[model samples]
Target: MDPRADSPDDAGTLPHVLVLGGGFGGLWATRALAAAPVRITLVDRTNHHLFQPLLYQVATAGLSAPDVAAPLRHILRKQANATVRLDEVRAIDPHARRVALAQGQLHYDYLVVATGSTHAYFGHDEWAGFAPGLKTLDDALAIRTRVLSAFEAAEREDDPLQRAAWLNFVVIGGGPTGVELAGTLAEIARHTLPREFRRAEVRDARIHLVEAGPRVLAAMPEDLSEKTRQQLQRLGVQVHTGDAVTAIDAEGITLAGRRLASRTVLWAAGVAASPLGSQLGAPTDRAGRVLVAPDLSLPGHPEVLVIGDLASVTQDGKPVPGVAPAAKQMGAHAAAVIRDRLRGVAGEPFRYRDYGNLATIGRMAAVVHFGRLKLSGLLAWWFWLVAHLFFLIGFRNRIIVLTNWAWSYWTYQRHARIIVGRPPPDE
Candidate 1:
């Protein structure tokens, strides 16, 4: 029996909706439920919802963390029905409709698991210490420190080999993050950092983007992928595809049996779903993503819904890409379903709509593929900028981001490259 069914008169009592993880999905779910006859409790380890698409800009010193993120409370301050809890989820009990947190537990009539994903070092967990992935603010800051500090260390080094090792930067992935990082580094080399160094020649900096796939942006169309590869190469990024990194260490990386010495390596290769998906009592894919139904609910537990990177959704025989737009749509669909059911109406099936695929190479260069439509070069770059600016939360953030982009465009210099905070002792 449905929990709400036991108390029919309690329909207006405001059903409790528990949303886990304040990422794109959970944030959207909480926002969508704010207007409904529901009390929402959003839980996350942090107080802010990060805009992950522009995270590369943060890592590369193009933008600061706040410019791409907003506090959760500030975002939902006006929503009286919604509240946020800065607590980490430890476990989920589907049968009892309870989620175990670090401090206590939360019970709900409707539970949404949008805990998102984390980087997968494959089987080599030790590699993470050397090659950090860009997921959170700390990771970006750490990368910035490593990149900037490398130049500093090289300037003082007397040995040529040691200086070259410090100047060598490797990005282990050819996806959007890797491509963006590599392209930005090229821009820094070609335009920005010449004056930063007095002794070390900045031109010796080598940026290599390594990928196991045959081309960059493999998820996109082949033509677009080729275009991106060309753009990356044109920007002086060494695009290496069809070769896998066999080993990674603080000293360097070994790819396709070839050893390359480097001190800075960024990982953008793989991602796995959060561990909360295992508590759903449902089947999961290889990446530990819960295999959710069309409605994004566990097989026998309709009250329990999963979205974002945690839910493995297949549509039209193709798995839905784990992107922000898809997560937002899933969150909205789940919200609409709950709202309709609360009114004693049947809920419709959830359908995912593919907006398009876009990846930027550098200034005035990007590739976009939407169905049969294909665009690249300056026009696509403009579209990418507009889309990212429009989607960024908060008017202040949008304005700040637009101003930063305009400044970077005319000057070809990234402003937020200063490394702050203490990194790990090894870094």
Candidate 2:
């Protein structure tokens, strides 16, 4: 059966499945269960499914918001058994088997909690006021405004020190997002913005990547991480390993024992699960992820399944990382289990397949680690680009993204660099 096609029994009297969050996991779950004789309702705070891997590009002006996001309603509108709702989930009453939303309640015969994650500032939540992480579209636009405004403000400042602070950009963490951001920002300063700003030396802007670990891309192989560090340095990004951020303010960041003066700070350090897991009163790991059973179901509540960044699942006694593919696999597995239960058949435990990892440093530099095999440089970058492009939903988005990437590659220009919103409300 074509899951995308509408049928007369699309509104079948099968079991009702409610999936939360329009991210990778929830979207995948909805797709996997499309052919099943079940009514599906997908809920999220936002109305779009974000291609998170390319969110940094949006923030850095490489791609527009629409290029990396697709409307949720448009995606599942053809599936007769499926519906989309834009609402914030306030709480989950597991005993009552109901999800409380800001507007009303949703009763689920089978629940899938794929609420995803948010940036964690350790215990120093105040730092978030200065160093905003890239998670949502608003965060991307806010960072873009701060970045572009720095150049505008620099042009007006006569004091050299103040201008330097405006030109300096600091990114916390050495993960994929941080590394990609630092590299792209460096390119923008060195290649793109220099022509736009005549008065100030945009090329002289400093980009620093601060990481607590001894090396960048610590999750990857050792050699790949070392190579990435070198590639980033070649792009003129100051790589600071073994350095932890102590404080962050509007002026700058305090790392190790020294103070770095900068007006722009991007936080990509760590992430914690969404508050929905805690609301369920389920056992969570250190990262605040719900600990689920082998079948991706809450303990003693087989009817409810939790996957993606919100749930902590183990395979071969090792915990799964909160990545896109992992989430997709878990979501598919959860849907299978629900289908089996509806068919009066016992379901097997969910198993996650290791699908390697990839992180790109700059335009043609990347690192990929697939089990024991590792590759670096341009080849890895190509792989990364193709993988991301292949995963994005809809042909129109794929064409748009490809066009944007090709344009950026040929001209070294970012088209989505426009600054929106009112100008700081006039001091």
Candidate 3:
């Protein structure tokens, strides 16, 4: 075993439980164990816990980065038992119960791995340079620049073909991210920037949502999926289903053997679990997600638990999705199991509670599937808005987001439309 790090008197006595990643799973697990007897140490490469659902909004210029992120230290300031570390994990020695960090090694009595997933290119990683995915604040900002700059480029181009290429925006994937991005892009063309540009006809911009599956939102019911397609169509988004992207380059993508001329191509298709999962020396699936026991622990290492996108768990013969809700549930369950272990009681098997699914298209259009309660249109949109606001971490952030949404609704103007990092087309 590696040498233990120097610690305070209290930290040495209490059992040290190290949690990796400050995302939904790790944060929820740490917070759930607030009153537990163990000393908790939460480590993440990034300082902020991002609200991923609204990430597309940032990419679409509807919201800023701070509106959807909160510092990890600030969130855990009141938790006397928790210590936050801003560092990345390099390796994990399960037998030694030690995790090697970029800075130093840390020994733990118990370890919780919640490191999340990243974009997957399905054996074509080179495409990543051309098709950016929305996974972090940086990715969102970069996409926002690419999107806004596309319009600027179109305005200056005299050649019709080049202009059309600049105006064509393609989102590869029909999932929630793709749907939201494509729909919002369409809205920006039709409603937000119609009067902003003098040379470019923003309304003529084409927004295409490409999906490999037969329909969009395959998780929802067929009726809701059809309704989502119809709503996207109403927003002027071209929905292309059952056509897989065979190639992606700097200029555009090729789908169904047809060349698509687009400069802004966004990826939301697939995600693979973090590479840290493989370092655990545990069995992982093809996507690199560790396969944990029913109790959310490693098969032979009960002291090591895996949750969130890093864990490959299943219930009722179906794999649990890598969604925020599932990760939160797993985090809480891991805490419960650890607490139970302290009491000499065996931990119960983890059971997931399905809370339904939701996806917003545009303006006042959305879809909600809760049990038999299926809703769409304005009612569903309001439900989506209220639910998101209630879950936001900070009151200040919630207020800012709510205010932004209200202002955008009344005036159809997106204030977070500033382009950064890249030079303007005029320059």
Candidate 4:
């Protein structure tokens, strides 16, 4: 047992601010408190802080794992008052001001819960076995393997129908992740893998994007949604709207009155808050997100703050969207509140600043909704690329990602297609 883990600091004078998860929210909060008079500890199951916005690029083999993630310790190496722990938090005793970890226990003066959310199966958890969701690097690698392996399976298949099934791909949810995935799959068929397979004509592959709502990108303007659908269709992706997935199995999924025979089914439909939120004993919505106060703190527990996807915050009758930007704002607010408390000053309520949204469909196809300034097509694509590159942490990561995107744009080849684990055997 390390002596430092027992209390705030070895000297036991400074207040300790314990941050859960190394995602955008927690990372921002920890950095915001770099000059504060407190001891900071950031704990996460994984060692690296993942840039989740471009996580799909990794799944589609457009970039490698290292390009989108940086080690938490490496990120906070210069922060003398901060400590990074690569361990999962097992339990939190808010009343006791102690947290139970998988390895040990820790005490803290303040706790920020930014554990984030995971894929929701909507009461049909069994569908997860057949259709995987993209959230982590592991999920991305698994999907990449399944997608690449499906092509390999088609090459070995003798029957035309079986080969067609192998070539068929279905993406659930018309949100940004779903749209991006379906579009990239179409590009892979039409441009990336057409010449690689000798027996199978990968160009004949079918990519389907299924959305339960009336249109894809439902959060955007209706005209933009229609444009996104049109762009997806132009990329050879079959866009299905207003049809929810009824059933799913190893072979395919049943939607409405039709069954789609597909070998790879990717899920991007929904997300539920982390189970840790429920453990806090706070009021939560149907999705298990804690109904945090205006200050992003638990109702009865001012010392415990919940932010990011795990927190359900409403501003002026509008619910704050669970995006990276909102999370970052909440994190910064948490830091500010802590600093104010140190100076015997009252903290102001957290007010979210909407920065707009960006979604890229495919090559030279994208849509940006920044308040009244709407842009689409090639201009939006370049804007999206530049915005992501600028937000991506670490100089090396930005350079490597830029180089990879430039290379892929010219050659239509994804270099990080190496499969680490053995893919599922063909049935």
Candidate 5:
């Protein structure tokens, strides 16, 4: 099929599909439907598709912002059926099959709500000031600056207590992102930054990984979580489990009624669905995710579908896990549904295939489980690296990430460590 053949159907006779958000789900939906005979309009507040899994790398100064994001227009300009719109979707009128955007309204024969999610600080939103979460490129860069500046401050401070506080780094949550950040930061403090700082013992810097749950990577298998916890502990990260953070401030965090002094705190705890889900009046669960049917469609509104992190679909009577592969599968399923509907053919319901779960603890330690198959240590780490490299958006990104990883592995150093943006101007 000619990829550009579907562009000239401006007469509005063909089906018009509107996809909201340019993240993994929306981008995958557009790609899957590229060859279909439909007019596709992709709208997003930002003009880029972000690789969220690698966002921690940016926060740890291992990768640059542009290395993990691709311009939306540049990504879809070659597809005849696809048109990228830089607009924030304010609301969705499912009854009328219309989307309200900042500039104008768009009518769709089929609507795909792929709006992603944002970090949630539970009821204590004020804690965001002291503990920032990693979600956007700006967030990563800000974290990178704060992390690097702490070492700088420690090097210059004359008081031993003040220097110690500056050297202490605390990370909340034991998810994949938190584990990666804590491990990478611990490596930097113990190995990389010690050579760069004088008068201060960077190697003595304290890195803490706190989890409210009993173990890290709670979603993974028990053995994997235990292995990850052990690996992190070996890397000089103080792992605290079964403790909830009560408060956070510039000085440090309060856990189990005990106060820890630290200058840098990273939040990787919880997340809520995109506001777009609420705007649609769709039934949402506790996390604000739209509760979709087995086929990932809105009930009483078959033409409208919700997918990715913004949606909650069930398999085996349990909610599907929110991950990149799940989002991709949902996007592809939505596209298949649209194709079948257009061709007047009945299709099967969406079924998700378990592709196993993988998480890397540090440079040489990782874990992977697929069905009854399990792997760990160097083998799992190699698999993790290969899986991520293959899933990255473009060849350029893959090459850049591979080269950076190679360089870091060889020298134990990170290159994208430059601090941008001026410090806050005197309050």
Candidate 6:
């Protein structure tokens, strides 16, 4: 489809598209452009693409890391024009249409920047050490280790206050990830650990879910949010809304003008766009997200595109929510634009379709909002279970996750609750 090409046979020498990140955005864009004439080079810091929504299960020791991730090369192996590179992008050169990597540089006729977002500590980066966020496999494993180690440490301590500190688990942020982590932690303490603990009464462990917002799952309908909040409380999660954390350290967190003593804290709070957005040399929002054009391209640089959580795009005067569906839709739109350019046709402006929201509390409890339909309790949980399993990347992952869920559902036991690093060797 290149204008300079004498015929279709010469299209292989046409444009080169460079896609950054292997999340939902970049992966969908790469697959969408499969039949296009351009050659695609997908670069990401990690070799495997992670299913972030399921990462909570790993953090809570319900699933292993491998159950939620798949190799990028394995995904694109069938695409003849697609190549995967496990490299980190350092900077972007718009004039040259190239990206600077740690080891080398890459040039592209069309660049898709979908590097996604990272957990933000709200200008309190130091709090990161105490309240680790679950965004990667390492983060999940680290949290698992901390949670399990806390119980083990408590077993050795005889002082009541020290044991209480070990059993106090505080989760900042009431979004889906926070709620899930808090709920699963409650399940583990109230069910799994109680059966295993010999000396300490682990069932007395306190789990708190604190949110600065007015309600949990603010993105969802108010009724559903309230429903989810109720379910969490029923499962023994202390829900604190309209509360902000002022500080976090080895001891615990200070929130709502009070100090809570705890050794393990999980952060599922606010997120800022990945630092890669600034490399585009474009205007970015306060959270460091690039403002994209109507067609999902960088202003004054149509060849350079930004999507996913890194780009700020609005529909009906509302910014597109940073979710897997929205990211995939934006990626497809960007691919369509490139396909249009190849046919010498101008692409239409991007439009986002609004889908409903879903949030689960614990086993057999969830909330869902789909247009006029609203559901909660066990029915919604079933829907949530099916949707996530269907969206999982690999057949093996789906099977493993389903097996794990069934095992937990029947026995109230977590098979993958083993800790990594710093733990005693099996031998």
lDDT of 1 by residue, 303-388 (tens): 88899999998988999999999999999888887887688876677798998989888989998888888999999999999999
Q: Clashing pairs in model 2?
A: none
Tens digit of per-residue lDDT, candidate 2, span 264-351? 8889999999988988777999999998888888898889999999989877878898899999998899899999989888668888
Residues 271-312 of candidate 6: C-alpha lDDT, one tens digit per residue:
999998887888998899999899989998988889899999
TM-score of 3: 0.97
- Weakest lDDT window of 10 consecutive positions for candidate 1: 2-11
Cα lDDT of model 4 by residue, 1-427, tens digit: 6553574434368898999999999999999999999999899999999999999999999999999999999999999999998889999999998888988888888999999999999999998989999999999999999999899899999999999999999999999999999999999999999888899999999999999999999889998999999999999999999989999888899999898999889999999999999899989999999998888888888888899999998888988999999999999999998898789886789999999988999999999999998999999999999999999999999999999999999999999987778785544
List the candidates' TM-scores in order: 0.95, 0.95, 0.97, 0.98, 0.95, 0.95
Clashing pairs in 4: none
Candidate 3 ranges with C-alpha deviation above 4 Å = 1-11, 423-427
lDDT tens readout by residue for model 3, 315-409: 99998988899999999999999998888888889898999999999999999999999999999999999999998999999999999999999
What's the residue-level lDDT of 305 in candidate 4?
Answer: 88
lDDT of 4 at 179: 97
lDDT of each residue in 1-427, candidate 5, tens digit only: 3332233444377789999988888889989999999989998888899999899999898989988898988888799888898887777899888777777777789999998888899899998988999999999998998898888888889999999998899999999889999999999998788888769999999999999999999988898899898899899999999999999987888999998999899999988898788877778999999988777888878788899999988789878888899899888999988888788875458898889888887788888888997888899999999999999988999999999999999999999999877542211
For candidate 1, give the lDDT of residue 391: 95
- Whole-model lDDT values for every prediction: 0.88, 0.89, 0.92, 0.93, 0.87, 0.89
By descending lDDT, how would the candidates be arranged? 4, 3, 2, 6, 1, 5
Q: What local lDDT score does residue 180 receive in model 5, on the 0 to 100 scale?
A: 91
Measured with C-alpha atoms, the lDDT of residue 324 in candidate 3 is: 92
Identify the superior model by lDDT, candidate 4 or candidate 5. 4
lDDT at position 389, candidate 5? 92
